[model samples]
Target: MTNDIIPVILWCVPRSVSTATERAFMGKEGCRCWHEPLGDPFYFSSKRQSLRYSEEECKASGNWDKDIVDVMQTLLDPEANNVGTDKKGPVKYVFVKDMAQYIIPRQTLEKIHKGQGSQCYRTDGETCGTSRCTGVDSEGEIIENPTVIPTALMRRFKHTFLVRTPTKAVPSYYKCCQDKMAGFEFFDGAEAGFEELRILYKWISNPRSTFNTDKEDGPGAVSFPGKAQKQPLPPPLIDASVLLANPASTIKHICDQTGIPFDPAMLSWDAKPQAEFAKWGAYHQGAENSTGFKCEDDGAAKTNGEEAKIAKLPQEVRNTIERNMEPYEWLVKRQTTFA
Candidate 1:
């Protein structure tokens, strides 16, 4: 919220090279990026008792409702040193990379069931005036709504959705599951990343967004949370293929779309993970192994891009790929293309 620092949120699905994107932002001088601030909370609030991570590990991750609230507050804290400078002076943005799935609608239901009520849905005074999290879906259907995260909180930042073809991202995500010792049975074909991305995009597109205001609770009052009153432009959509195809152009394009100055440093970074990411590096090895985007190849080395290899994949995995394609294509078509 500072005059000098713009808060940016990069929301992507698992194995989208999102960590590398975060590293790109981290490369910018004076910019500090968080790996996944909402991860622990999301894990703690999850109802999946038979998860791969131990219950103790999940508990150790922390409570979702409390953690998200804390992060929202911190990101908006005026006194914090969220702004840093390069040769151009003050830093223009603070980036946070998070998986779209980290925020859960099911967790909201779990909270309500526990009598925690809707307090978990509140954001800063400017972004959220009410506790109700209702919105119209892409289909124009209106119904009772429980946000995956507070809508008010989401409106506070410049958001970008990083997407990859499911034929690639799904199998890679499965590999991560295996690496973590989570059995293959955990993979769900129905939990496509685009489904949640669309939900977030639609909510963000709505003009009736809650935001900070002087009146905490009043019958009727106008509030301002973001840059202006009208619905802001749709968040920037960057395809992973586009990013890898030409990292410099893609990163600059993203900076332009988000209103932040492009920093050449964003094109590359040290291969090592940041100290804050030490606890989560095991899951981020792809990013850790890469110093920058791969241009010599199509960025498919990690992914089995061959038709033969894809055909050899388990039938269930192929089914998941088939199911995810519709949404993935829906998003990819909207992405900003570089030449």
Candidate 2:
């Protein structure tokens, strides 16, 4: 039944205006959107990799014990309730907005490269029975260079990316962390999220990759029992600035690419706080309050005191952004342009 549903994931960096992008999709008929579903498992699950939050903080936040595989299953579930909705029904399309960092934390990836097996968790939070459980194939052989979420599971979605310039994104993220109401003592620079996005993008775009080994019939040509399937078109990349500069055309372009019908009504919605976003504290306040897409006075102008702000950022934040700029620009060059 789930196979009949179209699943789309918008992998994004923090402060990339992705939540608002999710809101636009919420206005689309028959589309159900999930806001950062993988984050719960990544930050709070039993097999969690981050220690940034203490035990008390973890307990205060609900969904502190979700498994990665279980969350992935939920995303693929057609009848799963839409964000902020209790009623269940069939959905033709499922849209997920999530950070790439949540899918595979940099530290976890490093551990895998060092030959330390990260335990694979079942839906029940129990570890799988495999001896070295980075990821196991259908036949239970260990997958090399495993992502925190298995590659096989990741291949199921039509992936896309939402990127923001490090100059703007880095400062915005730091400001969020500095907000007392946002519930963080200090920012974790590792969560800047560009490196992981690049890695996933490359893996998805590579034709010779093992992720395309499925012999099932689909959009790509059919493969024999042991043959590789044809490579999929590379995922679309959307820059936050470009999306904001012209929301209607940009979103239409996105719809055209993803096989969704373009509707002008997707440009606006009732402004209110969403129950799905409440659990994250103030991180989503901007999205929660937005009535529609609006470019800031200097947003498209590109002269918005951005340089001044970047200069004031802490040295660590500056360094993180500097390290991420290469990948960020690489993605920017390939972003889908509507203008």
Candidate 3:
């Protein structure tokens, strides 16, 4: 069925004000919002099992992948939910906030192999898997097949990336987990980092390239599928620091990019947190406490001090921050700037 609602997919790292941004979108007229529907699969994946999350948590949250798929189908179906009647205005947006790392890499690879809008490196009819990356093959020649994003998902939304400097984000994230999870060990760059964000951005910008091909190849020049039509621009990148500096303006800028009207309701919300957050409130206390985009002077000062404390972090943490700098800088350059 035809519908005007735009699907807004927000990709963010932890502690990047992603929850707050989701709340802002919730306040907007004709908007339906969702938290990390993708979090469970990512947390349960083999790569992340020993990191910030635990298997016990995964067992408690069964079938997370199915949950996300159902939610996505609902959001995409114009006739599935009566979205327009919930607010005075006709529903025109579905705002979903998720982490870049939350996308299951293995699943994405599988879909690409099935030709779910993904291209790949092939020689003699042997399509390469995730291991086939950009670099010298045994023949000593450069193989440059880029890992395209899964088009089945990419075509579903106008994506936006929310980023923060590693110095500010990493410490804040570690502290959050420490407060919530008992005996949580300090994670290095491999566990808590911006590499996933960078990887996702590359795929989004070059969705026509090979999926799971290689992260290093980046978005090599590729033609959009439809002949002669202009390709859509890559998702907008919003810096948390920039958004916090001027929340209203930054949100408006983002809305414009996503083809949605800027609603004043997005600037504020109820003093109490919404019922929707109950399922994950433990991990989202900061957003729950905020009533609006306006940052208090004292709060701002405290945050600045906390950010400054990054220098005093342990050596391993410092090293992780350094490792994250490359990708963080890449996204920062592409972020939406406010005057």
Per-model lDDT: 0.60, 0.70, 0.61
Best by TM-score: 2
Off by more than 4 A, model 2: 1-3, 82-89, 105-146, 216-232, 296-304
lDDT tens readout by residue for model 2, 145-197: 23665555566677788899888888888888889436674776667778667
User: Which is superior by lDDT, 1 or 2?
Assistant: 2
In the range 1-339, model 3's lDDT, one tens digit per residue, is 346567778888887888898888887777777677665445543333223455565555564234443445565565643443456656667788887665635333332223222121111233435542332345533233222333443455677889888877877766765575323444434445386676666656554443323333234213212111122465678888778878888888888888779987788887666666666646676688888765534378887886678778876667767777888998898776555
- Per candidate, the number of residue pairs that clash is 8, 0, 2
**Candidate numbers, best lDDT first, in rank order:** 2, 3, 1
Q: Select the stronger candidate by lDDT from 2 and 3.
A: 2
Worst 10 residues of 3 by lDDT: 221-230
Question: What are the RMSDs of all candidates, in order?
Answer: 7.7, 7.5, 8.9
lDDT of 1 at 58: 62
Q: What TM-score, computed on C-alpha atoms, does each candidate reach? A: 0.73, 0.80, 0.71
- lDDT per residue for candidate 1 within 166-212, as digits (tens), equals 87788887666556632233554434455666555545543443322
TM-score of 1: 0.73
